[model samples]
Target: FADPSQAYDEQEASQEEERDGQYFEPVVPLPDLVDVSTGEENEQVLFSHRAKLYRYDKDLSQWKERGIGDLKILQHYETKSSNCAQTIGSLPI
Candidate 1:
């Protein structure tokens, strides 16, 4: 009788080959020009620190951990207006 294990291996190999044969084209063509805008491009970071934030709960009479993120103080180049931001990755928290 044919080795059951060998048959299973052959079947798996054929399935992998079938998967490799399939091709997918992009539904939409890539743009020639792409602008990488992060909104903070115009601004300059005055300060950046990795910190953990907390809030005091009056009802619970305890401190609650808000989140841990990069705390940044940004200042605009032209306007010179400064602001603080707590962000996790590229997102504001």
Candidate 2:
């Protein structure tokens, strides 16, 4: 005699499997970075990875690293001043 709409559909499928097991699934897997810049109050972003450099803090959201080498020599320094003005235009101007 215990039918009552199949016991309220098995108590709403056990409260939707306990709200899908209270989700939370980060077991490492984040670095594929390559943003480049943002900060200056835009709340940080700056990533690069591999050749190093990473920021994305944004009030501690994550991805901190920051600094090592070759973020295209830190986001292009005019290609090292255009290779030092082509080595001073072959020396002469």
Candidate 3:
């Protein structure tokens, strides 16, 4: 009998490989946690992984991680307004 955990691991590895191929490295570090909100005042795209939330800094031309304590995100949603973009996430307290 095939081990369920092993099967799950293999499946996850295959999915990771597929994701890696689709998303170029260095550009998107964490694709699953990355999202874009497009509206009028440009788009607010962000990325997050584990406890760190990252935003693109135009002046620095780099992705900067925000230090907001140990944040455990259950889910995240990006909302766009006429002139702004917002990202809302469910974090465990």
Candidate 4:
């Protein structure tokens, strides 16, 4: 007879594996970037693998870069839910 407890463990393990692999699309690492100001909404992350520059003034956001240099990032987006403490712990301090 199959052990019920063992089967439960196996099922849990599979679920974990599936969840981990669900985010298959890799995000390009831009460790040097950061969001300088505090806002109710988090900064956005663009898919393009290039740095962007902009000027901000009380929600007056404008792109200053058109393939210009000094594309260092001032903010990076956090995709995971804010309620999930584990996800935030993984982010850079």
Best by lDDT: 1
Instruction: Order the candidates by TM-score, highest first.
Output: 1, 3, 4, 2
Where model 1 places Cα greater than 4 Å from the true spot, the runs are 1-36
lDDT score of model 2? 0.49
Please state the error at residue 90 of candidate 3 in Å: 16
Clashes of each: 0, 0, 0, 4
lDDT of 1 at 62: 100
RMSD, model 3, all Cα superposed? 20.2
User: How many residue pairs of model 4 clash at the backbone?
Assistant: 4
Q: What TM-score do all the candidates reach, one by one?
A: 0.58, 0.21, 0.25, 0.25
- Tens-digit lDDT track for model 3 on 27-90? 6565576565432234333433335557899999999875443332222234443222234343
lDDT of 4 by residue, 1-93 (tens): 999999999999999998995755558855777767534256443322333334455565554532323221333366543321111122321
Return whichever of 2 and 3 wins on TM-score.
3
lDDT of 1 by residue, 1-93 (tens): 999999999999999999997999999999799797867887999999999888999999999998889998999999999988897655687
In terms of TM-score, the best-performing candidate is: 1
Give the TM-score comparing model 4 with the true structure, all chains together.
0.25
Q: For candidate 2, what is the TM-score?
A: 0.21
RMSD of each: 6.0, 19.5, 20.2, 18.6
Worst 10 residues of 1 by lDDT: 84-93
The window of 10 residues in a row where model 2 has the poorest summed lDDT is 81-90
